[model samples]
Target: MQLIEQNYARMRETATRDLTAAYLDRAMAELRGELTPRKPEEKALTWYDPDQTVGFWARRMSLEAVAHRVDAELAAGEPVMPIPADLAVDGIDEILVTFLAFASRQWPEDFGDGLAGADGRAVSISVGTDRRLVRPAASGVEVSRDDSTAEASISGAPQDVLLWLWGRGDGAGLTFDGDPELVKRLRYLLKEATQ
Candidate 1:
């Protein structure tokens, strides 16, 4: 959080906003230089873990860039740009499986209650041709393709679903059917996972 605090302080400085831009420019260039030569599987340090891999951090940074781009657009009162389906799909998979499903060790305090709220309740998420079911499991919530018993569903374009998961959008563009409480619980869990 130290780096984030420094960045925020720089942005809030009363001297000149151009200084903030210059600092960000230098920081981005430095980050690119550091990461450009790293192999995907190479061990690396990240905010989330002391020793993850280059690929993990790289993927996360790429998604953060997309999310921040949307943030900037919305802040500027500009229409949100289109995200490539492949990137959106990959983002959805990474956030759900990598961060939420398989990584119980990183789960937040409310994970158990959240999982219980979703028990016997599966929400099918359809992104383009990709389909997944989110349901309770031994560890937190598990996302799978077993949609045969799905009692709820959220279907939308790839970008929409990805943005929804990131809390970038209100999901107005997405179609949600079945139990609202299940969806609310899913949103709560998402807030826990992302924030």
Candidate 2:
């Protein structure tokens, strides 16, 4: 995927506003024409997985765009628009289920080092008390979305939780209870997974 490498390199190289905007416009136009018509079940290529579905890429791209928009807003000292609760929830789910759950796929070498100490206890993250996302913080991360027990719980509003999970927002509106060790492990996993 030379284009992927090229795109990443281009992102690191600063360009004029016109050039950047033009490139983005062309990319978006191509995406609309090519990817928009693809079925959700259709096979797609991802940075981490080539055997992914169009639906996976679609959800991932949407969440990535939102995360980048937040980064732009923060970089420019501009106010970020409120993310809808549903989108925020979905973004949280995506990060937890795909990114953290598949941590080995991204950085297998450094991943285990980041997760040195693990007791195999789970952390239950709550999105307004309705969603119970339990993920065990271990060398091999896994998320179980069900009414499960965990050693720790982090509860917050959907958007706040999503932003905090992404390191875009402080955990001011969030509350943590139960085992601190579990929370620490999970937070470290989240940071490593997102990074």
Candidate 3:
């Protein structure tokens, strides 16, 4: 951790915004090269499937870059721009489908209580017209689009939902309906899984 911090400090000392932009462009170009020659069976550690690898990184990095930009803007005492609806929706999908889904499966014992709630209990997240229901399943976690009733529901714009899920912003403008305890449990589960 100390070495990582030192490296970051050194980079910060030498990096200007223009230099960073140039570096990012070069890095992205190189990353694009990574996909060009690699076969599907080539080993890679990705959160999503091989067929969806490029799409997954594009969505993941878009959200990560925007979130990091927000951090920079905050440090500079500037207001942050909102994320686009499409990107934010993809971000939500990434969290629920990849991050949390894999994490719960990888650490079933830790997530057992949080995911395996009472029978018929589930939490729903709605961003505009997009709705996803998450419930504990025999396999680990089950996520699907469902308009049915749920034990708890959170509704907001896609950007707000993404930010709230990532613990970046307070959920002041969001609406939470139904069981508060369940919502809190869901929040805890998200944080734990992400960490």
Query: Pick by TM-score: which candidate is best?
Result: 1
Q: In lDDT terms, how accurate is model 2?
A: 0.70
Give every collision pair in model 3: none
RMSD from true fold, candidate 2: 5.8
Query: Arrange candidates by lDDT, highest first: which order?
Result: 1, 2, 3
- lDDT by residue (tens digit), candidate 2, 79-174: 766777878889888788777776544565556564656646778888875665555534576677678677788889898889988888878889
1 or 2, greater by TM-score:
1
Off by over 4 Å in 1: 1-16, 46-51, 103-105, 108-113, 137-139
Q: How close is every model to the real structure, measured as TM-score? A: 0.81, 0.80, 0.73
RMSD of 1: 5.7
Model 1 lDDT, residue 35, Cα: 66
**CA lDDT, every model vs. true structure:** 0.72, 0.70, 0.69
Residue 178's lDDT in candidate 1? 92
Q: Give me the displacement of residue 75 in model 3, in angstroms.
A: 3.2
What lDDT is obtained when candidate 1 is compared to the true structure?
Answer: 0.72
